[model samples]
Target: MSSVLYQSVVKNYGALNVLRSLDLAVPDHMFLALLGPSGCGKTTALRILAGLDMPSAGKLFIGERDVTRLQPRDRDIAMVFQSYALYPQMTVGENIGYPLWIRGMPDAERRAKIDEVAAVLEIGHLLDRRPRQLSGGQRQRVALARAIVRDPAAFLMDEPLSNLDARLRLTMRGEIKRLCQRLGATTLYVTHDQVEALTMADFVAVMHGGELQQMAPPADIYDRPANRFVATFVGNPPMNILPVTLAEQGIAIGGTPVAIPAARLAACRAAQVVEIGLRPEDMSVSVPGAPNALPGEIYVVEPMGNETLVNVRLGGGNVSVRAGRDFRGAVGANIAVTFDVSNACFFNSAGLTAVHRVNSDGE
Candidate 1:
């Protein structure tokens, strides 16, 4: 069992606390991404797990061993950093075989392992090339090959793809995902990229201000965010959040009623002022006088190749609606928007709606 566990881990620097009693569990062979923006203590947690930094308090375990004070090498972990960390003077083959060489493996065995890892990563043809001679993606693969050759108990990756171009990053995301599945190693990947975390990880632990905000599979994190921060951060265009008053009629924005499911309204009846969340995809331009139509002026329109994003100034706040590519609505034009209440979310003023509320049909 190669599960990585952090029990009430805390890291502090003088008076400034970095990590605040974080308790996390990563199942065996699980690919879990510690995701957050820079300075959120995600990297600190990864460093602690890798034995590069010591925790201020609490136990760290890799499998059944209490590795809280173990050295990096003694922990039997492989780390791939954001820099690729390839040696400029060494060939790709040498780089991949370095760990085995240090372990006193025979040259023949080292060469065989290097060749195997190179072939697995599809970089066998470039084994003779130096780090500088290879492209960014190839160098990244070389770094990965080096780590994989170790066959360590766990793999720690710190923003390993942050250096690649956008196209290469997308390509490598799939490659990394395939590699993790093929090896079935417990991997702890640290990255600020939400797309990478959402698409690759078996589970995602969202960190904010050195605290664990939420941990769950990607779909649940998106559809039902644990709090306002997660709700606003995970989405691409982000959910449109508005301060509204809940009443018997429905939700009201700027004192004007907006259409919402009766069941949702009833569920949040205890809260007077609630923050309503609607994904951009759930809103559309509706015909004037349509049922539950919200009148607003188009603030701006962004035409993506596949769809158009239209920002509307509704009452005191602004909300963006995702429209079809054929949408030719001009900016500043008065338009009506309709809501899909089935997918709506309601949060208290403090920004917490623990359970997702059902619509009228109980969906």
Candidate 2:
């Protein structure tokens, strides 16, 4: 496996811009997930990498070889699409070994490879069965087995597990991650689900409005977002972004200065207007005036058994606060919210967000 680079690639559709000067790098044997909401161009990026679509401008490389103009078959890459893309007429064994067959591999070798992948994928029992005989997850495994049989230079997966239920998706997530590790194949995965991106990939590329915003490890993207868009889009409940003003006394959120230790306030230089980004875990309900505390009302309570998400309204907007194992809160109840300044992130007036220190708390 070798590095893959998309050098300032651009794509357009008539009057619409699907990808804007997108540049990305996936290291050898690295599992990279392209994450963003629908219409963000993550799918388009995967298509370009697999050579199903050519870039309007800029170059693409697989290892050191340029592949910008290469066709899908010429790129030596296997792609697993969200639709499964399986042939209804083919048996599971034949489906899995289709790639090897296309390359004119000997019958004995093809059978050996099919048996190996089928055993790994636990689909050996279903080899004689057609795709319709298997469940969604089983069919997905067949799709993955096809990709693995060829031992291509890389694998491009486009939301291959979106159709499975929650439990099945979780099971398949571990299966795919473990398979990729064993094969040491450089994989570029595309998904709109943040949890999928966070849990499955070694690194994540967060995209927005067809532009690449940030690319880093999952923990880095979650704890230290490059900007507000990445911060809000990459988390489970997402980060809480609020408008604030920097006054001479301290920081005023919604016209009220939050009480914090003098030592902490002293470090912040007053800017005309600054916004604060807080994770749900950053705010705690506790004694008033206990280090950056603000009074707010609990507007919504969503119980998850292990944790309760309390939505608090303050500064003209509502934001969720995560409570420990089990903390009770009712709607319209007044609560004292205190921020863990050490875990806080700051953004400028233009809403360009940056985590204050990646090594602070949650380091």
**Top-scoring candidate (TM-score):** 1
**Backbone clashes in model 1, listed as residue pairs:** none
**Distance from true location, Cα of 277 in model 1, Å:** 0.8
86-143: candidate 2 lDDT, tens digit per residue: 8899999999989999899999999999999999999999999999988999989999
Report lDDT (CA) for all predictions: 0.88, 0.85
Candidate 2 local lDDT, residue 186: 97
Off by over 4 Å in 1: 271-273, 354-363
TM-score of each: 0.95, 0.94
Q: Candidate 1, which ten residues in sequence have the lowest lDDT sum? A: 353-362
Q: What tens digits encode model 1's per-residue C-alpha lDDT throughout 234-351?
A: 8889888887776678778766677765656777676544777888988899766787777888899999989999999887589989999999987888888888666777788777
Candidate 1 matches the true fold with a TM-score of 0.95
Error of 1 at 152 (Å): 1.5
- Candidate 2 Cα outliers beyond 4 Å, as residue runs: 259-273, 287-291, 354-358, 361-363
